[model samples]
Target: MHEQREFIPLDKEQTPMDTPKRTIWIQALKVAFPHTIPILAGFTFLGIAYGIFMHSLGFHAMYPFIISMVVFAGSMEFITANLLLGAFNPVYAFFLTIMVNARHLFYGISLLDTYKGIGKKKWYMIFGLCDESFAINQSIDVPKNVDKGLVMFFVTILNQIYWVVGATIGGVFGYLITFNTEGLEFVMTALFVVIFIEQWMKEDRHVSSLVGIAASVVCLLLFGKDTFIIPAMIAILGILTLARKPLEKGRVSVQ
Candidate 1:
């Protein structure tokens, strides 16, 4: 006689709701904080400088805070500072902003696939996609156990905090502040390098990465530093378009 076996569910893992909301947020913050350390140092100093500069220009402390919160772009905010001193011209300012932030176009294109299905947080991600934040978020592969959205959100918020706080403090106490902060800018470069190496190590095939490096180098050599980015972006897009089928096939085969 054949024996009967007991039936059991294949997968009875804990769902997200099973965990406490506080625990979930705490975990996300824990994962996200280390990545923002460099930003903390860099943005704090830079924001302070920006705040002091605005104070020197006779603007109120609140000006730096409001601009830091609203504009959020370091270079653009600096440009806006100069623009504030100049004659009023909204039309010129509009085009100038576009020119200053044109590189974001490439960033948006590169992130299209990755940003899908992220829900409402996607808008904030796009809004806060500074060079450092994008580098960290796109390079990171969120672990299966953690919430990707929360981690990214915290990263964005923390970076902004460093900048805003610095700017606000500097603006309020510009007269009292007198200290050298020459090398703090290097933190941003170091952060990018770390992220690049992490991404390089994680990839099974460095085909696309190599292409990016090669194209960037070639364009930089040919076009000079100030105008090579657009060409490099175009080259990357073309190369990726041509390689899409093979890349997709390799991904499928691996899966």
Candidate 2:
């Protein structure tokens, strides 16, 4: 044959922008409006309680207004005034708050590889990985041509709105509101119980719940309430790590 050169063609499909980006703001509003209503309500109540407690402890409304902006954990915000007043030790507060919210560590790990290339948007998303955002992201099936980063961004924005509104308005509600807060702290425990029940219903894994309860009980009994969280987390992690091989071998659909 007359000399012919082989030619390779470039694949034109490599660029992501060729596909349409989903209406991120619209999808965000869709998810935020309905899903965030209850969040706003609960955080309002939580923040009101926090404001009342802080006021009772001789602090201004602005104390919670600021802390809620900075340390936005749902449960941790409630106890922070006490922790700060009792110890005034940032080190203790830091460890104690993280111990209480250690589950976020797992959430962060799950999201670590997924949030890549988020550009300047990465900073706030990391800070805003609160309970609601984690829950929303956990359930989403990333839509076609839509970015997870944007979803996370919207989730964070939505959550911060709720928290800020809660914090800023809580004092007004607190002063105008009069209710006995005796034992109301149980709301935090109840919230966790509800979340656990929801997760359990979604996943339908008896072993996970059993292991969690068992580890929590064992740690609480051994280490006492304040210090037990660290050990409980360790126990939970150890058991889950051990189950990884079996879970993978069995091929459960969980990510």
Candidate 3:
């Protein structure tokens, strides 16, 4: 019997013109969207509440959509609502935004290597690095053959879409809906608590966790709730920096 060989197309120009370049994006979306389902539910409800809140304050529907797209930080966007109502203080608002998002610094540090070679997509990744995106992208292992950058990008886009859609609908129906949404704001708090617990469980040592709690408590006692976050962040960074050598030595010894 003659040996059989698989036929190969040797001509480069024979490649199909419509070969799907978009397949990567489609695959990424398929993989990423399911991971964000919980966030979809949460952001949608919160966005609607925010839109209703803005509507009640006489702002237009565009306000929520624009803010959701631009700021994209749920907690900070809510604070923006209050800032709009208060006296103009750009300096305070700037500091408050930095304080509220100080966690991103840690996220950036953790993702430095993960994002090193993603090229231009890195900018968008950084811009859209919300809590949900960071948690999902950091924790989950990207499946074989899936583009990690595209997956992360889609997660960011889908989340923003959910929020904007919810907020827009709520704004449009602001006067039509009269249901009290008390305690709805607690969703974000509960979400973060779950994230914190999950992160704590994944760690070998609880040093960082303990430091966070202790620092926050100390700051809250000293500065009160409204002003505690900034000081707590400062303290946490200081403590972690000071402890870095010991932590690194311990990690090395374990390995």
Q: What RMSD, rounded to one decimal, does every model reach?
A: 7.4, 8.1, 8.5
Q: Estimate TM-scores for all models.
A: 0.82, 0.73, 0.80
State which candidate, 2 or 3, has the greater TM-score: 3
Candidate 3 overall lDDT versus native: 0.80
> lDDT: which is higher, 1 or 3?
1
Model 2 alpha-carbon drift over 4 Å, by segment? 1-23, 83-90, 142-146, 178-206, 221-224, 252-255
Q: Where in model 1 is the C-alpha error above 4 Å?
A: 1-15, 217-227, 242-255
Per-residue C-alpha lDDT of model 3 across residues 74-118, encoded as one tens digit per residue:
889889999999999999999989988887898899887666556
The digit string of per-residue lDDT tens for model 1 on 1-255 reads: 213433221112333657877787788889999888889999998899999999999999999999999889898998899999999999999998887787788778777766655557778888888887878777766677887777887888898889999999989986786576778788887887787788888878888888999999999999998778778888988999899999887775453
Candidate 1 collision pairs:
none
Q: Indicate the worst ten consecutive residues by lDDT in candidate 1.
A: 6-15
| TM-score (C-alpha) between model 2 and the true structure | 0.73
Instruction: Give, for candidate 3, the lowest lDDT window spanning 10 residues.
Output: 7-16
- Which candidate achieves the best TM-score against the true structure? 1
How many clashes would you count in candidate 1?
Answer: 0
What's the alpha carbon RMSD for model 2? 8.1
Candidate 3, superposed: residue stretches over 4 Å from native: 1-20, 88-92, 178-187, 253-255
